[model samples]
Target: MNIVIVGAGLAGVSAAEELRNQGCPGQITLIGAEPHAPYERPPLSKGILLGDAEPDSTIVHDAQWYADHEVELITGVPVSEVDIDTGHVLLGDRHLPYDRLLLTTGSVPRRFPLADRSGADVVYLRTLDDALALKSRLTENLLIIGAGWIGLEVAAAARTAGGTVTVVEAADLPLAGVLGPELAPVFVDLHREHGVDLRLGTSVTAIEQRGGRTLVMLADGHQVSPDLILVGIGAEPDDHLAVKAGLDTDGGVLVDAWLRASDPHVYAAGDVANQEHPVLGRIRVEHWDTAIHQGRHAARNMLGQDDPYDRQPYFFTDQYDLGMEYVGHVGPEGYDEVVVRGELDDRVVTALWIRDNRVLAGMHLNDWDAIDPIRSWVGREADEELRNTASRLCPR
Candidate 1:
């Protein structure tokens, strides 16, 4: 059977590798818009931007690995459309037929509304090209729009490079959507302690080029001139192909527990898949770990393997001096209560979300102790003594 996979990000590459490993033995073609091979993106704003690592260090598989497995890699080309009825994918002028297909197009950064042709100085960081361009233009003063994970990471990088950095965010606290208000202060401290001029509850009205520098006019009638600008508000899933094909599209491409889309022939995974989580129930997540797990699980399911895809969600971010690790799901109601394992000053903080005396989800900032305990706590009854002890709420 001929299998075609569009997108060569982590999810797409994982699916292709899993297919070969499952001994499909059929022709496999992987197409990617990026010129480089599938590489880890979490480090783009951290290690690579800080000059600690090169771009090649993040590659999932080298050229030799693809050749050894007889997997074809098509880079720098995008699949314009998919012919579901004909079982084919249309490139610019080329068409390739497939018995099964996997969509792992991933996501793209959301640019600011003010970033029109007039706002040429404004930049974003998502793909390698974006990073490369931003890297080139980085100078003494850098203005950052949004204070999310990526924006803060860029701030760290800019500070390290001896650039004066300022981050503007409309929200009261950065990362309110992810770690919630209780934990966002830690990030705010990280930037402030690093000498970043953070302007919270501020929004940009317009960006104008002034004397080779960029002027960012705020809604409150304040303006800051910077040598360069980087916008990192958030990312939107690239689900155009799935939507155009008449596949079910919700927050992302809607899929069942098996990661199968509306059309059973086409499966969606990675950031693009709005898949059902067995543990979290019917919720869609855009996480790196989820992408890898779902991509492989989708491949296995495509090969007639009957494995229920219940996964404990996991993702990590490496900032200036900390590796932030998170696991499990935080309900909409939010964490019932937070327990700190380590002191903030010591740079080791593990915040646990407890409900009914059990750990629902945990966020570890520079602390690895919560990793194993969190895995075991999910889907199990609450342990009062352990929860109290683990949370350090009770007297030692």
Candidate 2:
């Protein structure tokens, strides 16, 4: 059997490795659009951008690993089309036939609407090249045009590099969409304490390059000039191949509980797969852990295993001295109440999102031991005693 995977990100690489490990004697082909091997993206905004870690250290697997594993690794080449009827993927001028195909085509960063101005002074931190470029230009004043995870992370890294940092967000608080209004102030305080000039409830109207510096015009009729601008609004999944193949798509490639697309021969995982998650209903997750686990589970299903991909969503973040691990899912209605264990000001706290008296999600900041307990509390009612006794919430 010939297996073809279009994308060399964590999901694609993990699927290839899992297929090989399952003793599938098939010709496996892995394709990537980027020149570099599959590398961890989380470090790009933190360690790699801050000069604390080298690019090589972030690689998922060394060059020798692929050769030793007998997997065909093609880099810097994108699969232009997928022919579902013929069961083949189209490269620029070549076609590769495959019995089974997995679409792990990650996501592309959203850019500002300004097109006339050259992006020479603007940066988007999605790929390794983008991170390196932003790192090289981190010596002067840096302005970030979002307060989401990527934007805040870049802000922290820029501040660490001695660059005067400013963040502008259309929302009233940073990460309001994900963490909600109640817990969003924690991040607001965190950035302000670090000397980050944050402009909330404001949007960038225009960006102009004048006198070698970029000027950012805001909706409030205020303007600010900075040495560089980084746009981190969000990302859209690369689901063109799936959509062109006549597969169902909404926001991302729609997949079943087994990560199988509409066509049995084709499957999807990672950021591109809008999977029908058992616990969270129909959702598409862009977290690293979800990608890794989904890749492995999808590989098993491809090999005739019927195990469902039912793992709960998980994500982590690191900024300055603060490290956080979040678990569970809270839907669109938002949480009824939030219970905090430990002092938020001290930076060692676990915030639990309670809905219908059950713990829907929990975020641990600077506290690692709460991961297991917090995960176990999901779907279970928040203990009244534990809520009051902050010390016992995440007991040692």
lDDT of 2 by residue, 1-396 (tens): 899999899999999999989998889999999998998888898899889899999899988999988899999988889999999999889999999899999988876767226443677789988898899877788888889999999988888888899899998999887787766888889888889999999998887777776777889888888877888989999998888989889999999999999999989999999999877789899989988999888887888899778888899888888889998888887888887777767878888898888888888888888888777777777776556544576432
Q: Model 1 reaches what TM-score against the true structure?
A: 0.94
Q: Evaluate residue 90 in candidate 2 and report its C-alpha lDDT on the 0 to 100 scale.
A: 93
Q: Write the per-residue lDDT of candidate 1 for residues 268-346, one digit (tens) a residue.
A: 8888888777667777666778888888998899888977688878878876787788887776766667666767766
> Residue 44 lDDT in model 2?
91
Clashes of each: 0, 0
Instruction: Score every model by TM-score.
Output: 0.94, 0.95
Query: Candidate 1 local accuracy as lDDT?
Result: 0.81
For model 1 the local lDDT of residue 383 reads: 67
Error of model 1, residue 357, in angstroms: 4.7
